[model samples]
Target: MSTGPVTIAVVAGEASSDLIGADLIRDLQRLNPGCQFVAVGGRHIKATGAELIQDNEVFSVMGLAEVLKDLPRLLKTKKQVVRTILSSKPDLFIGVDSPDLNFSIAKAMKKHGVPVIHYVSPSVWAWRPGRVHKMARFIDGLLTLFPFEVECYSGTGIDARFVGHPLAKQIPLQVDKQRSRAQLGLSDKKILALLPGSRNREIKELTPVFAETVRKLNTSDEWQVVSSNVSEAKQKQVAKLAAEQQLELNFVDDTSALLQAADFALLGSGTVALEALLSKTPMVVAYRISPITWWLVKTFRMMQLPYYSLPNVLAGDFLVPEVMQNDLTTDNLLTACREVINDPQAEQRMMQFHHIHQSLLTAQPDQAARAVLNLAESLC
Candidate 1:
């Protein structure tokens, strides 16, 4: 271990990235006890003792319109972050997820002679493939969660590594469904996990559709609906909708346990969908964005792949059904959920998803942590 103190800069703009950043910070501290961390992050990263240079909420806006509205504040925060990095002259910088903010900041850092390592390579393969060229120039190394992302980055000559997903390592290799249910105080009766999403924007866009779908399922007594707790405000919003629809919904903050207790899930298309896959839960994915954003995506044909769910992406087929944007409706979501939940062979097929999860775990022994450390070592 180096005797001298090393300052490392990190930035994780949202909840999922914050979790990954926290894990990386913990592993980095373990690897080099003298290392110091400073960055823009949330509660999890703060728990790891990273000095806050800026609050992550400044850059957490989603959707085109939302981002555009917050552009001025976002730009000011970016300048402050860049100024901090330049003044500190850290040994290395790690940007975990949040490609939009992280990529621009990494570009600035690289120009100032700092080695930048970007975790969670953006979905360039899915949309905006041209970003690979820009990323190759700005980022010293790129760490990816998905195996397929490596090929995309390698093709562009970016120093990229498939670090596997942190969740794959964090979640248990062998899941005991019955034990999980018992731990969550759930019964042997079938359970349906509802991950409306963690962000307020996501909940707003998805809750109505989700509640309607649950109402149509009308299997209130037969299947338990467990809605994830995003925040108190969002909880109230979702609760209001559930109450309005007279739907029985269990809103829980302990999402991990809730997911594990689930027989299957109806998840919004994002990190939660991937988490559900890790829990080996058969799921139907649904998502709806602002109408303008939806139209933009469709007009540009931004989605290169047919499926949105990560499990389906990994399988290279429509293994899980996705109803997105204009296509997402109560009837479609209900139908997909019913098919997946009621199928006699569903449990066995979901085991196949677990196989995919196992394959993703190829980056073992703390791959996310190791990748960040390797990048730090290369810089030294």
Candidate 2:
């Protein structure tokens, strides 16, 4: 092991990964008091006292078309970040999600003999299994959030470990809906929580449709609509959109609290689906990427998974409604929302949600921190 304090360099591309990076940083601080951190991250990661070489906004774009549109800026940012991290020469480099950019950075840093640990395994098991072979060549250790992910790296000679997911620990096994509703000052009127998404592009694509669906669902005054906001900018955009449609929407700053208080969630496909599940809230997942990107994914036969949403993926069964791509219409969303809201087997689905939550509870606050430090010190 090194005689001096270890310096860790980390990069988290978007909001969810930023949360994971922040938690990992807190744990790292607890374990190695003198260690320092540098990163390319968002507000949450920056809050942990890590020196930010770059903001994560440039790397936040999703889909092939979306990335291509921002390619020039992303490439430039990546080059600058890689140069800076190499010059700093940290003891270990941890890439939290954003496999597209982080993988490139890891490859460059590994050439200079830096130990590279990737925090979230890319969706190799879901699609593009070829990536696992390429990952084995550069990543010294792979830290996965899900239990099944470790099996994907079999015989790759990469040190793969399941650290569980931080959200499993952060969100309790049982959430109190009445208490959450009370905290949000909400009345018990069968709330339907709307989560268009965190990104501006998603807000643009999903809000109008979500609002239209809510209008159709609430025609009989059977449901109260609550829109969950991630930031003030996004909240303002959603509020403006709601005004244009002349729709009434209640806004909440806290997503978990809204999810807990909600009777049903109509959300875009992402980490929020998992949040809804952990909160024991029933949901219908929906998404719409650029048309060209969806066409490319189909034309090339790139997608391998039978289901796209995390809840169904984990359960190995179709546990929720997924209205996506061409199927993501206002009518389709309304239909799915009604199906879940009035289903007789809702109790069975809730039990399955609890089972999945228990399975992901393997994480300790310091589990990932201890694993990362052990690998770094081993190479020292």
Candidate 3:
């Protein structure tokens, strides 16, 4: 007996999710050989040969204020997505990250008798534990990055699997610092990478602080700051900022290379933190958002982790200092950056980061792709 192609609908709402979704699609296709995919994604996902219904930009709001501004567009897109999925009736609906958008869409699609798999658990373990109940109602399975997240869905009887982070598997545990530096054309002198963020708004809010911090740090050491490019617009914005600040900066399309090249990194909190951790690069995490959005996040108590950086969070300690909101000032950021740069024990701490990196890698084949393939097989 021969099985028909398994149709999977995937929605990935951010750059990191786009990369992960693309890799997942490749693995799923490898397993079934004839699987079909359609949904909203980015260039990376498009490269995987998936039919794109919409681009991820439709649902890429970063903060509460931003979400509010884009609410009407988001709602319209959600309706369109629901209508499309209902018309097509895919066997599996894979929601890759973006809990706010994907979870709502999954909830609506569940009524059509499609299995909903939520990849990347929203931090219910950290805050708003009540979300688990809603997730259980809509999601058939939850694929988590961290092992600790599996317990969050236990009470709801939700099928949760700890598929170690894709980055942990993608990046090497011990990067050759000299080789990376040589690849990026940098001297053996102290190198500091500035990852303001991948989003335009993130660069606007954090780049100034990061630039100023670089200026402060430059007083002590000749540091080379590198910015990651997500778009031409962001690259131009960062270039302008770097020029205005009179800072020596390099622009790279791949942030992973920048992480590997740097001795330490000053980054905005998000996916890059995990990437840096996997590269075993010591970093200082910093972030800033609109005042109203900050107030809302604080009032709602959504952020529960003591540290924002993924390495520190995974290590269950303050492995890296997090300077957020008011603390994200140039002076404070410089202090944190300097501490990581000057500390003699910094390399030792990065070695510990390497150990954590190894622990998160798949023991067998690529766990991320295998996990998605397993889900696809079950649907078939």
Candidate No. with top TM-score: 2
lDDT string for model 1 (90-142, tens) is: 87888999988998998888888888999998888777788888787888788
Candidate 3 ranges beyond 4 A from true positions? 1-3, 185-189, 376-380
Q: What TM-score would you give candidate 3 relative to the actual structure?
A: 0.94
Worst 10 residues of 2 by lDDT: 1-10
Relative to the true structure, candidate 3 has a C-alpha RMSD (angstroms) of 2.0
Q: Residue 187 in candidate 1 has what lDDT?
A: 71
lDDT of 2 at 168: 84
Q: TM-score each candidate.
A: 0.93, 0.96, 0.94
**Compared to the true structure, candidate 2 yields what TM-score?**
0.96
In candidate 1, position 185 carries an lDDT of 79
Stronger candidate by lDDT (1 vs 3):
3
lDDT of 2 by residue, 1-380 (tens): 34357788999988889889999999888778878888998888899999999988768788999989989989988999999998887888999998998999999989999989999889897879999989988998988888999999999988999988888888888989888899999987888898998887898899999988888789988788898765788898997887677678889888878998999999999889999999999999999999999999999988898789999999998999999989989889989998999999999999999999999876375788888877777664
Candidate 3 per-residue lDDT over residues 95-127, each given as its tens digit: 999999898899887877888888999878666
Off by over 4 Å in 1: 1-3, 155-157
